[model samples]
Every structure is written in C-alpha cells, then in structure tokens.
Target: MSRLALPTVIALALALSACATSNPDVIGRHEAQRMSQVLDATVLSSRPVVVEGNQSGVGAVAGGVVGAISGGSVGGRREGQVAGVLGAVAGAVIGNAIERSTTRESAVEILLQLRNGERRSVVQAQGSEQFAPGEAVILVTTGGKTRVMRAPPVTAAPPAPAASH
Candidate 1:
C-alpha cells in the first residue's frame, strides 16, 4: 500500500469519529431506560415554569481531539507534542464556550408532590422538547440526578375534610 494512502485512511477515520450523532456516550437505550425513573415526579404547582441551562459533553470531547490534532500538526515532533497539549486546552475552552452558546440546557423548576403528600419545588434536568411547564410530566430521580420524563398527568388527590369545632 502507498504511504499516502495509509495516512489518508487514518485521517478520514478520525474525522468520521468526530462527527456528532444521537449516540451521546454511545450507551444507546440503556441510559434512556434508566432515565425513565425520573419521569415519575409528582406535580405540586398547578402551573409549571420553564428554565434553560446547558448540557455539555460532546463539545468538550470533540474540542479536545481537534485541539490535540491541530497542536500535533505544528512544527516538528517535539513542538507538535507541545502544540497538541496547548491545542487541547484551547480547544476544550472554545468547545465548551461554543456548546454553551449553541445548546439549550434542559433544566427547569417545577412544583411536585410525592406519594406521601409532601409538596416541594425542585429543579430537574430534561431533554429538549421533552419537558414543558403546564404540560403534565413525570419526575424520575436516579444516581443522584433528577430528570423530567414525558408522562401522563397524575390525577389530583381529593381535598382534605374541613375541621369542625
């Protein structure tokens, strides 16, 4: 095989791997299934409020790789190594910044009630378009992370009896 051909194939492979896709962390439906538990949150407030935040991962990783490659492409072998490290740092910073600017975070504040009749206001992370205020949703809590899941609204409990003197 030609020397140029090998390098070209490698470059193409790396570039292809850098592309974004639906597979965040490449874990597939496993994480989605796990996230379903958070969808069971109870509603406390009659009306829900929407809040936005940034979700980051792909940007950081892609930035790191791109930075490393750009850096390594500098000068000779020794300089290239140095460049790679610096590039990675710069890339990560830029990547995170870009992600922060481009991607809308999936966190929102909602009022919910637990089965035991406790009412609380909580902030939960959710996917875009999946959770909305005023729309019925389920809150799932798992692995110390809380997420809002798309679900049918839970029926409200009957009002308590009035006290008589």
Candidate 2:
C-alpha cells in the first residue's frame, strides 16, 4: 500500500488537472475570430444557472489501471490478472465521474426578445457580466454558440482618415 501511494496520488492529480482548464463556452482556436452575430435584444428574464461539467472518460481508465495493479498484487499470478481486470473497470468508472464533477461550471440563463419579434433563451457562464430582466443586452453568437454581454456604449465613430491633400 505504501509503495502505491505516490503513483496513486500522481494519477489522481493528473486526472484532476485535466478538469481545471475546462470552459463551458470557450470558442475554439480554429474558429473565425470575433466573427460574431450581434443581436439587439431585451432581457425578458435572467437567472443564475449552473453548467454541468464535462466528462472525457479519463478518470475511469486511470482508476481501472490503478485498481488493477493494486488488486492484482494482492494474490497469486492468476488472481493478479483477475484483479487487474476488475481494477481497470473500477478505475474507468471513478475517473470519468471525477472528471465530470470537478469540471462543472457556473452560468446564467438569459431570456431575450430579439428586435425582430423573436424569443430566445441562452445560458452562458457568468464570467464578467450579469443580466437583469427588462435590461437591454447584446447577444454575440459565433460558430453556433452565443454569449450574453453588455451592449457596447453608443459612440460616434472616429472620423475617417482625412483625404490626402
């Protein structure tokens, strides 16, 4: 058991580290940059929301390996092989669950009415903005995903470059 402690801890840490970088609504690198559809909408409703964590099946596999090695070491050669198999199964299950539970994210649900008389609801992570009912907000959608953000302040555009003399 003592010999297994370090490897077990390392495996568990790696599994958890994979969960720490998860973002529920991050645009991918290959996606077009800032090519978002800007929609004007009024918030019909807003509420706090939770985005469930994603599971990528890493936990179960790791758990199974650890379990197998630990289990197999406890008995004769045949028992060890059987133990390894059982360990792998148990590891996979636990690893997957751990990955999901640890990666859960916080979000907000916003109900909006588009200017064209359409209603839509979007749930996004509450990174820096909050929403309120009846508030005018901006919906920025890109690559089929949308984000709710504060409306850009209305301002006059900078004068176009002066014509050359």
TM-score of each: 0.39, 0.76
> Which stretches in model 1 have alpha-carbon errors above 4 Å?
1-59, 98-106, 113-117, 122-165
lDDT of 2 by residue, 59-91 (tens): 656666667667778688998888778876876
Ten-residue region with minimum lDDT total, candidate 1? 20-29
In TM-score terms, candidate 1 sits at 0.39
Clashing pairs in 2: 59-95, 60-91, 60-92, 60-95, 60-96, 61-92, 63-91, 64-88, 64-91, 68-87
Give the local distance difference test score of model 2. Answer: 0.72
**lDDT of all predictions, in order shown?**
0.55, 0.72
TM-score of 2: 0.76
Name the lDDT value of residue 128 in candidate 2.
66
